[model samples]
Target: MPYYCDLGPGQKVYLDNPGPTTLITLASGSAGQQQQSSTQIHTGPWTEVPQIARVGSGALLRCVTAQGTYTWQIQGMQIGAAPTNAWVADQATPMQATEVGLSSMASMQPMAPMEPMAPMRMGDMQMSMNPMTMRMGNMTLGLDAPAASTQQFCTQCGAAIAWGDRFCGSCGHQLHQP
Candidate 1:
């Protein structure tokens, strides 16, 4: 069963119910926003009560039924307002701290901060400078071009091709221009 405590300056409340209970409060303010006193609850009862069902925006309060789960958010408080029924029962990826140097993080629409990665060695890393040639190890790649004399322009991607190079180093286009 769950009960409400008069939240004094630093009072606390805990909820451990066999079935779910709803948390209703006196009208502290308007809808979608309310202010109240501060209270803390430490959930106890289930080893992993991994399901959450939201009755209302302000009604569904996660009664702290265990230690270390500080999830009983106060109503009208937008600090940690999680989506309704989004408890940890679904076995989804936990939101980890964002990293710093990940290439995939750069392409995110709203980029999140990345976690710092250890420095990578050249032998353990494989990256692509362009799209055609994937770099394997520490080596310079050369392409076939004109006979080391005639100026050649890349037919594709509009890049200049060096003499004796078979491919455009910049755009990876065929450099053997006539």
Candidate 2:
């Protein structure tokens, strides 16, 4: 899924630590608004750092990050708050630090409730709903793939299922009969 940033009126935007290219798909200011073309040689970051964007009104600025992507929103109208510059290069929150592997799940929503697993025997292993993985008490196990790689997985919970089985014993998801 793509990330979205909703900015209020007069709230400017900026790129903190960007990747190779932060493509601004939607700026939401003018119908004739065109993305400026540029080619610069930089030695520090991947793409570019400290990219500023003006937000006259409310808008959803959509951009893609390749390596280190951190889009920061600052109060442009307020002077005492911070710099008037749209984008700041340093950092904001600890979550924005791309070094900790948080950029991928920064805008993630809550996961759906998983169905309780029923007692089913699969090679003497207590299989759970997670795909190719099982949780026994607190320890988790990662199942190895077959040499032929003919393992069938449940569509709902990603648990390994028998090829001849109709319903997923882990999540009770119905499988199409072949």
Which candidate number would show the highest lDDT if scored against the true structure?
Answer: 2
The Cα error of candidate 2 at residue 124, in Å, is 18
Candidate 2: worst-modelled 10 consecutive residues by lDDT? 34-43
Candidate 1: residue 140 Cα off by (Å): 7.9
TM-score, prediction 1: 0.20
In order, what is each prediction's RMSD in angstroms? 17.2, 15.8
Per-residue lDDT, model 2, residue 46, is: 35
- Model 1 lDDT at residue 88: 42
- Where model 1 places Cα greater than 4 Å from the true spot, the runs are 1-40, 44-46, 63-74, 78-178
Q: Which ten residues in a row have the lowest lDDT in candidate 1?
A: 97-106
Residue 68 in candidate 1 has what lDDT?
A: 36
- Candidate 1, residues 64-173, lDDT tens digits: the string is 43343334333443324455444543432222222232222212346656655443346745443322233456663443333544556777876666667888888887
